[model samples]
Target: MGQEREQRPVGVRRRTLLLGAAAGAGALALGTDALATRAEAAPTFIRGADVSWLPQMEAQGYYWNNSSGVRQDLFTILKGYGVTAVSLRTWVNPSSDPANGHCGIEETARLAQRARDAGMQVLIGFHFGDTWNSVGVQNPPAAWTGMTYSRMLDAMYDYVYHSCNVIKYYGVTPAWVKIGNETNSGICRPIGGVGHPDQMTGLLNAAYDMSKQVFPNTPVLVHLAQPQNLTSIQNFLNAYGGNGGKWDITGLSSYAQGGNVPGVLANMQTIQSSYGKPVMQVEYGGPVGKATQVRNSLRAFTTGLQGFGGLGTFFWEPEGYPSFNGYNSSAWDETSRRPTAALDGFLNV
Candidate 1:
């Protein structure tokens, strides 16, 4: 009941470099501040590297099948792949303290350390749940189960503070953060969800206020589900005064790329324009199943997203399959063992 609609960000990106044509040559190597500022003054482009789910996998030594050799250091692997940052999702405390949860602040901090060791910026995804969290579902960490509204808000605050402080404690403040992932239904739904403009605005205001207070230097992004919801996203953010109006960068979750990378890229341009903010594809790209396929899609994806209000992107979870076991078994990868074509897209430019 927050709003019965969907939205997407917008901008039209020509294959040709719009502003910094000469500078926007290979990949991020040439994507310096001067180029970004120049593009922004007129129109900017997104140059990013997706290092989300690789570190832990490499460390644990599952199939991994990356291009650098199955045994190579993943960080070295990441830097060579042209990845400037790594994204990881935090499950609060997933498994019962007794159940032995998977990802925790401590685990994420360790991963962040590896990414930092490779000179990569870290994008910590605070999933806001004690377990696997997503848009259709936004459960609090189990510890906060059955809490009152007043306590719930405090719970959220603690979650934010704990996540940020833990990362900061190790001195790896993320480049950008999403309060919730694909909040197509709005965050903290049902309990303190906003069904009216006034209420939604207050809800967003509170979340944004906490984000700004905690991570002022690092931008906070509010994410929408997909391109189809671009407008509703804009409307909600504008009404709520979050990203569309003030949040630093507009973030998106594009599941379309799997079917048509170009279409997905085109949609990103459109959404970026609509949102009127630097764009970040917080979630996109996934296991292509074949190295050759990865190469083809990644190149087109790289070309399409360049020079048209393209800020950056995190390829969702390039290799998150292993952690999921048989349930998301497809998520696990085969052992091609050298930086996969997906890795090469950012690596070779």
Candidate 2:
């Protein structure tokens, strides 16, 4: 099991210390007066991997694929890599886009089972689309295309219920639940997008409401697309806040060079200071070749957020298998011998 990533021993006491090993504590040593400031306990969190590779593309380059089963081996590898969480995505249905079966419920369930069997947390991702989806593109799954808004809500609830029920049955409890993938535009349809400032809160409320019903204690995460639109991001949350559409966490997707990392961190500071919640850059990475640089590039973001009250971050797919290469060359090719240095930042090996 010894590799670049180190497996945290089981039965060892869990540490409550926040950012115990944060990168730059050197400069703080000289500033004795810094002690007087409010020492808000840093929230402890898990650094995790999303395992979003297409199942059939084993040749692609996800590091998780081994002989027995990619799902099982992926869990072991995550631990080996010092990651404590596994994110599973739930799509209303499947698509033939790549392998079509890549990260659908079928694969997620399998991965969840293995993760729990291996003692890891699961973060469930629900993409309300038939094909691939994200904040930038959230068209409803084809199955619900003609359905009205009311019907859509019903479908949403049913999907939520089904997801929770299925995962629970697998004996894999999710530590965090993302109601929808980056919801910057809105969920399901363009109508769901927050066009007018007034409907912003209402739309987010209705969406967040779905999670509250089934998984009351589970923290719900609201994610925005891209890092540059900080002002709009704050405004959207404020609107959501009006409807009591409170989420336990605030997340942003900052792709490589999507925006200035410092600007992104500043926006997160506002989220922490004004909104008062743990922040995370939910899905982030660079182009295929730039994965190595991502680790170094992202360091500033984490250091800037030090003591500002931010939760851990997740690099989109660190365990992807190159053998299971995506249809396009843009993704990390898991078929490669090992993950690129982008993953090394999280592994800290």
Candidate 3:
């Protein structure tokens, strides 16, 4: 889901702009290019886009243009901008809501197949809910709502196994698999909340085990937003680690603004060094009007994280334009119906 999601707690709502005070400390210590030369020797760095909105957008009469004003497929446009991968999110028995629905396994599988056909690596994100799931909310799927804790573990395993098999049946084996989306407070709440770390870890381990069962070679990620908040992340990592939470990659959502990219990258590097897990910026973007700023930030993140031996950076719902879903952090231009310069940041990294 896009960052414009609703029903956030009072203090946890997504912040669009970086506070001046917040941008001064670590950023000054680690400039954007501090690690640029080191990143030159890193392995294949993925610059991806979350086109979960692509099918719906196309159905609603939306298309994209190349830099020369020539109409072309969205994938072609993204490729021209140096995108090497695509991330798709899936829900469990999703509703028919136009903007916020219909990412069920079948739909996601179709998208994965298309991404594979385009020669881009695929990263599958499982929300494990019937609708949007984020740090703000993580309601269990309708079918698993009243299940007992033990029963919920079974359901989680079954769901992951079934979903993975179904997706693979569509002829797309994802390069990376995200167990959940922005699962900071924990997944499925109440039962999976941090208050009951063991329960949450139980569910997470089930998902991780099932994911490995299907895609043994794929890296599984545990995601959280707001990488700059050291206290929050350290607490979650402690709770997760204390309870034996399993993950191959530590995925993050970086919406860093002002000059906080350095601090954010520092925090990510810290996570990697401390946890022995590679990191990736799984979600990021900014308003289309801030195209140049967003481009620079993206470049910094991609290059900086690459230097840190991180996996990748993906723009969340970059295909989303105004009126499509009430989201504004898109990489596409509204009036021109073409990609903004924000995506150009992915190049030459």
Best-performing candidate as measured by lDDT = 3
Give the top-scoring candidate (TM-score): 3
TM-score of each: 0.73, 0.75, 0.87
Model 2 lDDT per residue over 185-218, tens place: 6666655666643444444544454454445556
Residue 6 lDDT in model 3? 21
Tens digit of lDDT per residue, candidate 3, span 1-349?
2122222322221121124326643652242123322332457888899999899989999888887888998888888878889999999999888789999988999999999999889999999899989878888899998888987887887788778877778888998899889888888877888788899998997787667667866778889889888777777778998997877778899888659999999999999888767788999999889999999999999889888688789998888988889877888888888888888889888
TM-score (C-alpha, index-matched) for candidate 1: 0.73
lDDT by residue (tens digit), candidate 1, 1-349: 1121111111111112234435643442233334334434644233344444454444555544445355555555555556666677777766533113456777777778777876777777666667655557756567767776656655565456555666766767677666666665665556544344454344444455455445665666667766655566656565655422335566777645345776667667876676555667776565546545555556566666665756665665555553433222122245454445555555444
Of models 1 and 2, which has the larger lDDT?
2
Measured on C-alpha atoms, candidate 1 has an lDDT of 0.56
Q: Per TM-score, what order, best first?
A: 3, 2, 1
Q: Judged by TM-score relative to the true structure, which candidate is superior, 2 or 3?
A: 3
Residue 49 lDDT in candidate 2: 68
Q: What is the C-alpha local distance difference test score of each model?
A: 0.56, 0.60, 0.82
What local lDDT does model 1 show for residue 171?
Answer: 67
**Model 2: residue 298 alpha-carbon error in angstroms:** 3.2
